[model samples]
Target: MELLKLHLIALFLLPTSTLGFNKCNFPAIFNFGDSNSDTGGLSAAFGQAPPPNGATFFHSPSGRYCDGRLLIDFIAESVGLPYLDAFLDSMGTNFRHGCNFATAGSTIRRQNTTIWQSGYSPISLDVQYLQFSDFITRSQNFREKGVFQNLFPEEDYFSRALYTFDIGQNDLTAGYKLNMSTEEVKAYVPDVLGQLSHVIKLIYGQGGRTVWVHNTGPVGCLPYVMDRFLVTAAQIDKHGCSSPYNDVSQYFNLKLRELVLQLREELPAAAITYVDVYAVKYSLISQAKKLGFENPFVACCGHGGKYNYNRFIKCGSKTVVNGTETVLAVSCKDPSTRISWDGTHFTEAANRWIFDQVVGGAFSDPPVSLKFACNKMNTSQK
Candidate 1:
């Protein structure tokens, strides 16, 4: 872990040319996604992700589901922007740089059930787009009033900012939770991506130009999926992931890539990059030991179970055993050395590692670095 940290530190110190990129002076960033990129939308809307979640960096439950920063946070820092304050949050939010519309349980398509019913967010991707649209108009109005001009983004910032998306993971899991067959889940991917496409177009219509889209990761390797879902001995891969589930996730990503290509054709002014975080994440899980980590399937902050997880008692929830109160340890003693923070989200360390790999466009479709994402690339350039 120390070695990885040092390598990342050195990576940040290198020149722009060494990383195959030029600098882009992005004044702001607008993000829309699920928990993977959600800074605080879900936490503020529901309840804050209770303690140990932000222990690694924020030093408190800073409304994130993981131990520290998410990929969005890393991206923000790299681009010289402030961490996006959740749009739902009315607290000390600063929208001057940007706003985050992502919630923890958000999916691309709206679910039939409420948050309580399906454990999925009612604020789906469409709702997020609405929120974003509202933010633009409302914030502008508020700024015009001159009451909080400093708290809002400049009118031109929206058009100049980089837009990021890291959703669709929950959409895949939502189907599995409903006992849908893998084929059934795969069948509806087009519909899901259709909604995603609509939202991106909506953003583009609103003047969003540089778009960054991350494909979903390997859900099968997540402790939450492995513990909650049923997988036979043969179903588990050599890396201990559910092969069928991973296949479904990969299929979702493949279609998502196609959608990106389609969007590029439709939106001539937009520079869209489809990031393959799935490959980077899967490699990390399958080669955890070689990558300097422990069993990747185990939850670092969960209660006792095969994967140190219980769907009923989540990472921050408590349980009583033998009349003794026990809080599922908010964080493990060595969370920095682990991958899964609470059976679902990645650890701060893991998030950092993932950020390092993808920032250089190594895992991106256009193979254009994040700094130069505004320039549309030829697919054949790589």
Candidate 2:
């Protein structure tokens, strides 16, 4: 454990692009998470996302809440894989590279609980695992029937794949909405991490070896949170975010980092790394002007509020606002110059920038790029 800690510390000090590091490539990628990383899982299941959500890049809603691709989409592209299909969209879907099981409102724990009543409930991390297990079973059956014909001739695909997790934000946000105090909301961290650890262990037990876990981002900086909780001047930070909410997010990220380290010691053969999404996102906010963001505090799409966000009006709703009778939640002329999209999600431009930094290694623990970490496992085995 001490050696591992020293190794990680040393890696952190190295340049983002360390010379001699191999680029990691994987046969498949299975992602599990909430909206931040969700591609189309929720859309496939609930049909809630539509139109202008994907207008910026896709020119239409492709199930992504953002105006274009997500971090996971960029990650897949970086690893040389096609866009992953949603796990729920199984009909005629190709699982050659893998499928995404992340839904917009999924939590680390089950979503049917009373606490998640106000949250979106399509499938949670627990349910995602069940779906993955079922996929494995189906794949095995197809192999026996010679349906795969050698495409997936062996079970090695599962062992050699990359398992990515980006969950828990919903858990934290939902609890906060229930009026839980900082301490009260934080009390759920251990259980959330415990459940996450269980999922990682389960994946390892079933042959997954490389896992990349993303710590939650700066939830307070999100337009939705700021508009909802920090409307008053005293409650807002200099960046127009909710200071208390950001503090809670930091606390969660700290605990998650510790959990990742512990997992490294416990699962010696598995390559588990934590991604500091909070720092990456906060940088965009703090350096908004330098990053080309004309406005970081306001949503790129929404209506009827100071932050360009209205909870009741939403990003695509049509409603009356302050005597304006047919006001619709409209998008900005140029989403590329903004950070937040629809009050909660990031714009595609923002996601692209974040992905570039993430793949560069600075945001990851062990200080190695994600591609390097994935390649390290294969190189060690060889």
Top candidate when judged by TM-score against the true structure: 1
Looking at model 1, the pairs that clash are none
The estimated TM-scores of all candidates read: 0.93, 0.89
C-alpha positional error of residue 12 in candidate 2 after TM-score superposition, expressed in Å: 7.4
* 1-382: candidate 2 lDDT, tens digit per residue: 3324534564656544456665666888989998887878877776748667999878887888899999999988888988887887744567778878898878988755542357566588888999898888887789889796444324677887889999988888878777888799999889988999998898888888889989999888888887776556786777767788888899999898888877877887888877888888987888899767878878888986777988877777766778786638888999999998998899999999888877756667766777667643222100
Q: What digit string (tens of lDDT, one per residue) describes model 1 on residues 84-141?
A: 9999999999899999999999999999899888789998999999999999999999
Q: Number of clashing pairs, model 1? A: 0
- Give per-candidate clash totals: 0, 0
